[model samples]
Target: MNEDTYNEMNQLHESGGAVATVDQLIQTLRDDKNYDRLFDALLLKKRLEMGVPVVRPTSFDNLPEDRRAEFEEHYVNAAREIGSLHLEAGSIPRAWIYLRTIREPEPIVAAINALEISQDVDEELVDIALYQGVAPAKGLEMLLASHGTCNSITVLDQQFMQLEPQVRQECAALLAQTIYRDLTATIKYEVERKQGSAPTEETLRELITGREWLFAEDNYHIDVSHLHAVIRFCRSLDANRDEVRLATELTEYGAQLSPQYRYAGDPPFEDYYTAHHHFFNALTDTDRDAALDYFRDQLAGDAPDSDKQLTAYHLVDLLRRIDRTEDALDIAAKYLLSVEDQLEFSFAELCAETGRYDKLMEVSRAQHDPVGYAAALVEQARTP
Candidate 1:
């Protein structure tokens, strides 16, 4: 609508005819930052060149049979072009709109990852990147940097089940590390203030070891709820990472808290921090057997049937993670097979994983499941 643009467009129309005029119009729209109109104009120009309907159709069924594929090809190409243009214009949300339409997520994911989130981070990017699942790690990074651990922990807890297992583990690991780093700084500062100064040490284990006074009078540092929630979320993380070790230190802190601060949890983890300390220790290959004995001992005591089943599943899962698959298979075959509930651990699947198709067939025949035995028999025969 600017006078100079209008005059130039008229001059193009006079000198170069209709196609050249529309080309200039698309450039004008781009310069004007009228992206929505530019998208429409691109499609319109394509349709005009193809001799298709100038007006958009609601259904493909309305188009001639011969033109459908061509139309679809043009539409896809146009979307990609406009989406790329939007990305180049630094408008991620608009780019996502078109890229998602074409089922092309990688470009948007790349764009999100390429962002420098150290400062001036936008909340909109966080919404799409994390909430929309385009790039969760980056979104979580932004959320943590902009907000802090409280909001990050809340998001992790609320969105935990919806995320894929690996992403959940990554997010949880990140939060655990953040909490550990912050707690270390606070504990170090407190220790220095108390002792008039202290030696610099790396781990929380080192920081809290000699300082029983840190937990005296039922006093503690940091948000206990935040600590508790993060340690709980740490269950999703792989035990090999340094973050998991940091989480173990968090549990160590939990164990040192006053009776009022140390709380109970559901089922097998009713001892809360103590149980998690053992769990992480087991996974990290420190005193694995003792942790195994501790969890198994929980099952020896009396509890509700549901509680017993859940405890059994936890022990079996732990055994499996530790590569004691045979032990896991044994406990699972004895306790989990008849539960009649949909569970993550499958007895047959575990058997197959351990290449014990004979066991699968044996159990199948004992239960009089001909179908199960038949499949297991085939699998056994195929095993070389």
Candidate 2:
């Protein structure tokens, strides 16, 4: 129909002429198979709002299995189109959206439970013996039986953690999933309790130990102390190439971000500038202070003062930043005597890199603690 004809039909439909408009819209759809999916989606939404159900073009159950697949596909496509409209308009009812878009029973359960709508979902059932009595319950049971592989369970756990404890407990009983003592699980639950969302990096660290935070993805049980050591080293540096590289890798892997200084990999810098540019917006002085304090506390407690831990050697770089050259020299001397071959080579390089020139000369001298010849070779590599 032309514009005038369409307008007249719409006016008639708004004035208790629903049946005629439905017939005309169906005829229009029949002729145009490639019209905008959004138009039909909106029309179905309007009808649903008016508490009207469209006549199904195919009897879903009576069709052969392959045809049933086609029918379900149409419903899902229509539902997605309608969902996009609702999301864009920001006025579409959420419950109706869930009823339309959720195809599988587990996802439906997750969606409704997330909303906590408290409506009698039971009364909406149509297939009394199948869906009402057996199908949904069976789907839920099967979902619980294979919980690890269920994306719906992940969504449900995330959503459930946001609800009040009493509400979460009620839902948990029905789903047969509990937030156990797994540190990540506990961290997630604790964060939700305090902030109504997941924990940020600094907050997560306050609640979980280094060992607790180093969970393996597949096994969930491995001591990744080495990984923790790597992180602490990056945290102490003022700015350097290696620190920036490590931070980039951690963020890409979805690891936590802290208030500690971010290295830009090239020298002339203000602290935390690279972090603001890429990972977050502007950083406050308070954020900088907190991160620096945490980094130093970790250094004093957890960071190793040995050559095998080359990253810890950044402490000398840090000491140089604060003008503690004498302390830096003492640390350099300790590491020089501490380890063998590769680590000794790296520690010697670190002493030179951080500008402990006098100590480098002392270690290479005839009066050195070790024989002078070995120290002479290290001093040669240190010189320009």
Candidate 3:
């Protein structure tokens, strides 16, 4: 790239009876630590070997069919080598440049995946792996491994959820699994240390099933706040997933803690862990009727008006999760339509679902909702 390198390249060209000038130039560039030009030099060498113009953008369509495959194969192999060299030097951004060009991310992704997460994750690699749109799931896994659960949850909540739906779900699942794993390990270690032997499996329920002595002095395992946040994220995971099942056990453990540790939450989760255990079990279809009945009981209490409405919406959501949308519509019409103001649950949408315009109009006039009344009238007219 410098004047001396240019003069040396010309000399190598003059003496190119046996060796190639581009190869000599690449070697010179590598020796001088001039990798920027080394990339161009490598491209030049490939172009010369393939008999393609070296300016830029080698058009595969213009090349002979017999040679195109060979050229492509060589190009991929060369690019992969350079990219791997950069990754070995802890230069993920530089490696990504070539890896992305070749549309082969497996090497870099595997590199990040192979990281011993107990050690520090390369911050630049995390940036490329997650934000730059390559291997996002593994990036999230690394963050969960190297960083603490609290930090991972905060970042996932504040940032990662904005990604595509599938990517967002993957991140959410990772958070749940990581939390379940850490919490399970902590409890397992304590049980093993206290007792002579512990459960060999990863079931949190079995670990704490009869271990009342573990909580005798008002002691706790793992961060209670992390447990709460992780359970909230676990809602996105499939009910039958192992992580969700493990989280269910976590709630069961939390339910048995002392009164001091039992924190009240909003309606439906008013009893926090106890309520969450019911909700999760219903999702997993284990003791399904009992969990559904637990929430139905919440619907009957003469609680505050707003709290009652919250329970209504929560109950509707639960029914909807279990393929009971028709039931959700009925509950929505009964409760959401009678609320003082606009509730989170949409009664209009419920009407649209099952042609329930008749109830919509009834509740609309009772609640003095002109918009609802008009929409229901229009919907009724459009039917049949």
Candidate 4:
């Protein structure tokens, strides 16, 4: 076929709408003596046949070992030839078709070719390779090397979930390395971008809490940096309520990781307890009873003096929550007096709530809290 005719035939085959013209061109090319055009014609035929389901060659598998090996090699070589032609022609979907025909395709080459044409093609080819028992680590490494986009990483994540447990674990281990840093960075950027301007407390909580990408089973080893980044980002918001919400989420996430990964730093149990305590305190009164129960349990345990003191503060807050101001004042006076400086704010609040202006002033003065002392004096002057 001449250049114009060949180009027109190629376009017809690609369009898939002019089946009759493509068939005529295939026949004409088949009759040609030129090997390159003949190869192009064969590629077009295979591309057209792609969606038409054909029974997998059952006999091929049952063939004698040597014959089977030869059979596989023949198909693999043919696919590579056809894929190369389409790849050079910038027809990725057609190229992927030929690549997919090979039982064990070159993931990096196929991914790079497909990505050069379109992200959708790259994603599809990677998924095909992964589901065919190609190791996700290998496929992801190849895909990422091509500078796969956010959508490509997402495709890998979905395919990863479909892998068998051991395979998934192996891939996860592979992805934990620095080689995949580009992919991880893209994923992180996409996630942060999705959070948009003025991400709410709930949004930050969701971002920090989930095991989707950063904390995927294999990813936990590398998760510490991400966790720190998220914590820093949350803090950067400079909103108290959001910071508390993120802290609570991080506390829970850390607790979940503690059993498996030592990378999650060991904050004292009291720190987690206090985080939960404050988180609940920031919520409505509905959580007050649970908060009270939690602190009461902590106090009843063989906790260290520091923990007991912190629990005492929360319990006092909970006591005031349930409208037992007198009980709250008594508890603060009894359990928190020795740690008065540590629990000074809670003690002062309790004193103010219970109309104990004299005690509030005394505690505030001893703690050198001038503001608290002045506030106490005002309350003292107002009381009867």
lDDT string for model 1 (140-178, tens) is 989999987788878867888789888888888888888
Per-residue error (Å), model 3, residue 62: 31
Ranking by lDDT: 1, 3, 4, 2
Candidate 1 clashing pairs? none
Arrange candidates by TM-score, highest first: which order? 1, 3, 4, 2
Screening candidate 2 with a backbone cut-off below 3 angstroms (N, C-alpha, C), the clashing residue pairs are none
Ten-residue stretch with the least lDDT total in model 1:
54-63
Top model number, lDDT: 1
lDDT of 4 by residue, 185-242 (tens): 4445546576654333333235444535545564442355444323322221212233
In model 1, which runs have C-alpha deviations exceeding 4 angstroms? 1-20, 30-34, 57-61, 339-341
TM-scores of the candidates in the order shown: 0.90, 0.23, 0.64, 0.32
Better of 1 and 3 by TM-score: 1
lDDT of 2 by residue, 293-367 (tens): 433443455434532234334445445555555765666565444553644334455555665545556765623
Residue 188 in model 4: lDDT:
53
Number of the top TM-score candidate: 1
Structure candidate 3, residue pairs in collision: none
Candidate 4's TM-score: 0.32
